[model samples]
Target: MKEKITYQDAGVDVKTGYEAVKKMKKYVEATKTPGVLSELGSFGGLFQLDLKGYKQPILVSGTDGVGTKLKIAFMMEKHNTVGIDLVAMCANDVLCQGARPLFFLDYIGTGKLDSNQAAQIVEGVAKGCKEANCALIGGETAEMPGFYEKGEYDLAGFCVGIVDKDQIITGKDIQPGDVLMGLPSSGLHSNGFSLVRKLFFEKEKIKVEQYLKELGDTLGNILLTPTRIYVKVILDLLERFSIKGLAHITGGGFIENIPRILPEGCRAYIDTDSFPIPSIFTLIEQLGRLEKKDLYHTFNMGIGMIIVVDPKEVDPITKFLENKGEEVYEIGKVGRGEKGVEL
Candidate 1:
């Protein structure tokens, strides 16, 4: 008889894939929300819309990947926290439109299947879903042997949210004299890692385990810190305040992201000294010999999210956010003449 080559011989292992699914089930179950109508293994993620208070309900969707930050996770041999980064990158963007995140789905592509590692990654995802008040409906785990490196994997996420049309923040109302408030970021929050990697690993030749007194943590730990989800606080603010505009500081940093919501003839004037910049950013700036403008144009610095509101509403909003344990800073003000950001 001719030799028979099984599917497992070709690199994909069905049995191992099944084991991974079994390991991930419990973590997936913990993220269930009322809107989730399907299980983890379904053909599609099902979320039943709850249109109780919304008259003209609008659906907002966002998708993002962790980018080169995954390289750091690979170096640290840590598989958990990147899943949270995956969810936050998407959920935070959807929140910019003043939407409540309803459900999330993730994708994991790897060369070989490791059940424990897959479970750990999903556990992080579930934890993030709980924090964001969203459900983990469904996802994919692809095993392609030759396509990826042995111990490395890629992760991406999709988030769906809902908001009423009238409640949507379009920044159309942003005018001169409007106050800009900022919420502090946890750390690097998963952007500019390509430059970071070059500065630390390639140029400075710093090891991941190296400790820095300025940051008070190991280099790897600071770089791997998960992105913060602003859904809950922003949603609460929407109910009690007239928020003119919202911006989630992501890949573009302050220079690019803040202008995204600015209306015609309105510019943002940010007082950079208003908030304390995180040490990790400063380290990158010094090591890379980058200019101040380059740093703000590439990283979030310290501010992760920005809220635009009328000057009259700043005091009350700041008080409410402070009461919620958020570090609030009166970062800037909207100005006339141009449609961009001024540091």
Candidate 2:
């Protein structure tokens, strides 16, 4: 008689997946807000819309992945913080639209299931959700044995947020004389890793643990820094300041992202010497022999979020952000001309 095959034989272990979910319950529940109506193990996550604060509420949603930054995590064998990167990637985008993050869901897929590692990753997600003041409602743990290489996993997150329709920051008000305030990033912030990996590992042949004096941290730790979530800061600023525009600098760096929020016949003239750029970016530039423009067009280069406010509000807003523990830079100003960025 031919042997019968079980689902487990096909590499899908229902039992192990259940155990992993069971372990992640506490972390998920810890991120629950008053709006979350479903438990962690439900088929779908539920969030009750809160309409108290707005006359016209609009839902804003964004989805993003950690990019090749995951490769660094795989190299370092550290899965904890990448989950935060996943959340930040989505949460910050919606924030650019003046949305208050409501709840987040994640999708994780791997070749093999490692329950402990899975739990660590979820805990990071939960921590990120809590930091952003959003609930962690649901996620998928897909174990495809042969599809991914052993011990490799990819993560993506979906975030839903709400904003008052009238309060949406479309940058329509951004005009000449608006000052651009830059908020510092916590390292690379989950973008441009494809080039980063090539420069550090393939070209430079550097090991994860190898220490560089300029970096002040090992290559592994520097690469794994969690992407910063700007939800709270943006929300707070929206309440107090007349922010003309907001830009979350990601994949295409300053050049690509800032243009997204600019109105017609306006340009951003950034003084490159205005802020203290972290050393990691300089290291990459030197090692790769990349031009100055390419360096600014790729990495965060220090600033993570940019705020365009009236020139008069620059001093007070800068002071307010400084008091709130943000590293603020008066990096540039809006000028009349082309609708692009200049540095």
Worst 10 residues of 2 by lDDT: 318-327
TM-score of each: 0.98, 0.98
What stretches of model 2 exceed 4 Å from their correct place?
Answer: none
Deviation of model 1 at 89, angstroms: 0.6
For 33-99, candidate 1 gives per-residue lDDT tens digits of 8888898788999989989999999999999999999999889999889889899999999999998
Local distance difference test scores for all models:
0.91, 0.92
Q: Write the per-residue lDDT of candidate 2 for residues 197-286, one digit (tens) a residue.
A: 999999999999898898998999998999999888889989998988889999999999999999999999999999998999989988
lDDT of 2: 0.92
Candidate 2: give the clashing pairs.
none
Clashing pairs in 1: none
Query: Each model's number of backbone clashes?
Result: 0, 0
Misplaced by over 4 Å in model 1 are none
